[model samples]
Target: MGDPHPKIEARAVTRVFGRAARAVHALGPVDLTVAPGEFTCVVGPSGCGKSTLLRIAAGLLRPSSGELRIRTNARRPAAMIFQDYGIHDWKTVLANIRFGLDVQKVPRREADARAAHWLDRMGLTDFAAAYPAALSGGMRQRVAIARALAVEPEILLMDEPFAALDAQLRTILQDELLGLTQTTRTTTLFITHSLEEAIVLGDRVLVMSARPGRVIAERRPPFPRPRTGAVRATPEFAALTSELWELLRGEVGAGAAA
Candidate 1:
């Protein structure tokens, strides 16, 4: 039977660290849901538990309280991309692409086919033989992203995946990632500090408060898709981004103070 639950669901999920006197509440009482094939962008100030939320969702860290449910099938589990390019210096671009498929025990030929597909799709065909060190920062991140997508995961969690690159390269990679996600229809939760990045990449942008973070506001961008060029110039886009900034300003200052 088809699953009735959301692709990803979190009910009053919270995370705290340390004892009573030194306790640091890192996240919720947070509630969140990402529908199948939806791309939701999360934004907040530094140290706002945005990355903490992703780690919890990715199953890397257990929540101290609340229920976090991820409905994933055997063939398509969740995958993650961190802010740092998660690639192996020793592995060739093509080998990195094949990493996840190999882990799944996919047949050699089929794994090669799938990895090759992503490498080409990500515009890394020319660099297929190169190691991570031989590639530029943007190229390495693309390899990381391609590897995650190559797994054909039902849900993808990314924590500021493109934050390391220069502005121009970041934009290019953003477009590439957006196009790939559209094609795959993968359910994704993307965490970023850039409001424009969130707006550009998200179907809905969730803004969180400072430490002990929680979603304080959200913007479901009405901008039409293929969200490529020229959309950011529109008044509506500006208005929505501005609203998001206003929501985040105080939180950013608070984060800075503490």
Candidate 2:
């Protein structure tokens, strides 16, 4: 019964920065959607406005024109996890996770309980008392995820959350993220530069054009859920990745030339 629904919709959304003669068209009128319980990844070269698009969806940045709508059954708004993890270095992991709930005016005891639950779920229970500085990159990211989930938001928007981690750590986090998504069934929109990562995590991959970014193509992986490391080796996976790479290579080259 957990059928996909339109949890987030972006229709003809355009974003421009600066004034008069210096104006920069960061994003074109892009149309996109994130379905309920689906993980959609947006991949493109640098300056493709992937992060800008996500910020707009999270309501951090207003679009110069067009519309972005987030709909969910929950009263809370969507939560965002940034590439830097965005944790308070001075605060304990538990404190950081509880921060959102506190802002929402949830009771202290209730917030602490919810934070504890997610910390345990994300395997951060042992580091509850530790500060961001004391944890490794992966642990910091887990705390970020726990913090976002603590609020019980209907949607999760991630802007290359694993881009800074090492290869090994990134792989581990990818699997962990998938597990979390499966268990909670949260609607997610993830942005990444790694095509392999996009294929691994995304139900649908949206490839964007360079500069004045727009959705160039949308590819749905043929594989089923509960995807594991083995799926990447299959012929179907290879073909899909190759096709995306072919399309992306030209955009990346064009961006470089500009």
Candidate 3:
């Protein structure tokens, strides 16, 4: 079948919010595509509509104009992992991971088995019976990821999932995520403000302009997976980060000024 098509595609998608007096142009005529088994990261200054773009791709919000398409054989469109680890406080780790499967009417036993498999793989088996409140920030985010993978969707949409963790924990989780992606090969669209993260994790990085965001640059990383601490110190990695910073610094300053 001619190698199939992109797992998700966005064609001139735009999103605007609020009424005339308070109307905000969050995004404008953005075009992007995420291929199967590829990892793409979107980065930009604050309030540049990075999150808005990701939400549109996930079908969580409809674009005000243009088209967002997700092609998948699975009934569930895409699974999202939020920055805040959006797990239910009342639900135990295992239960939270199984929620999507439960909603889709997968057999309870099968769902439990799948949850256990991911929990062990994610190193969260011991915490399965614990509630969200009991887990550390990193552990909670792991649960969020496991929950998304439970649904076995065609794409994973992540919105700064590691931003809230401490620097050390964030780095640790970043490496863990790289390993997870390698094993699962899930098409992913990850959003982040960290240039280091974008360089380290993404196969390609898309840089956006200031508010009313539009793609300003696209960079392909030269490193191979699984990306490690060593890659970050390489000349190629440093050069990519410097280039991305040059593109983003002005937008960041402008956003802050406004």
Candidate 4:
């Protein structure tokens, strides 16, 4: 079911890199809508432009054609969490978490309150004074997530935020993220290479085709929300995985070849 009121709308959005001489078609004139509080994940082959799609939505890149609108009724923009954990090494964990609020000129009292809340939720209260260098990859990503969420944006865009973590920690963060997003009901557009991650975290999972990417399949996991990693063990999860693998595996190989 779609949200009666959508938070993000991408209409016939297309992205191309470079000019005529050396052009690369990145994404589609694909239409996408994110309902407030919905978590939508996209999975595709390597060159399929999953990240490109996110960049356009984040307003980091303008679509080559068509329009991408954020919170149509307001001006609030989306916040993005990157795979590399884009936190400043010179800043303390708390400081990094509060950076967005600071930029927006949020009052110190309220900014501090928001930062502290997210740090605690992200399980980073103990590392508030630590720098990015001192934290594990997983911990660093938590800070990145905390920083993004602290701003309380209507839309969240994530680009493989957990792809660098060890398998065990990735699983842990995936569960934590699932819980956090569901609790907040934040609308999210996440990109991932892992099909399991896509199915586990997304209320809906979108599969994209090769370069010049366009959504080829959309899967709505029938499982109820509040998903923990344990859901990955179910028969339903396996079936979904198998179904998507057929569409994604060749793309994966194709992506690698490219």
Model 4 Cα displacement at 27 (Å)? Answer: 1.4
Q: What C-alpha lDDT do the candidate models reach, one value each?
A: 0.89, 0.91, 0.90, 0.89
Identify the leading candidate in terms of lDDT: 2
TM-score for candidate 1, residues paired by index = 0.96
Candidate 3 off by > 4 Å = 1-4
TM-score of 3: 0.96
Model 2: pairs clashing at backbone N, Cα or C within 3 Å: none
Could you give the C-alpha RMSD of every candidate to the true structure, in order shown? Answer: 1.6, 1.5, 1.4, 1.8
Runs in model 2 deviating more than 4 A are 1-5
Residues 91-192 of candidate 3 have per-residue lDDT tens digits of 999999999999999998899899999999889999889999988999999999999998887789999999999999999989888888878888999999
Greater-lDDT candidate between 2 and 3: 2
Worst 10 residues of 2 by lDDT: 223-232
TM-scores, all models, native as reference = 0.96, 0.95, 0.96, 0.94
Sorting all predicted structures by lDDT, with the top scorer first, yields: 2, 3, 1, 4
Global local distance difference test of model 4:
0.89
What TM-score would you give candidate 2 relative to the actual structure? 0.95
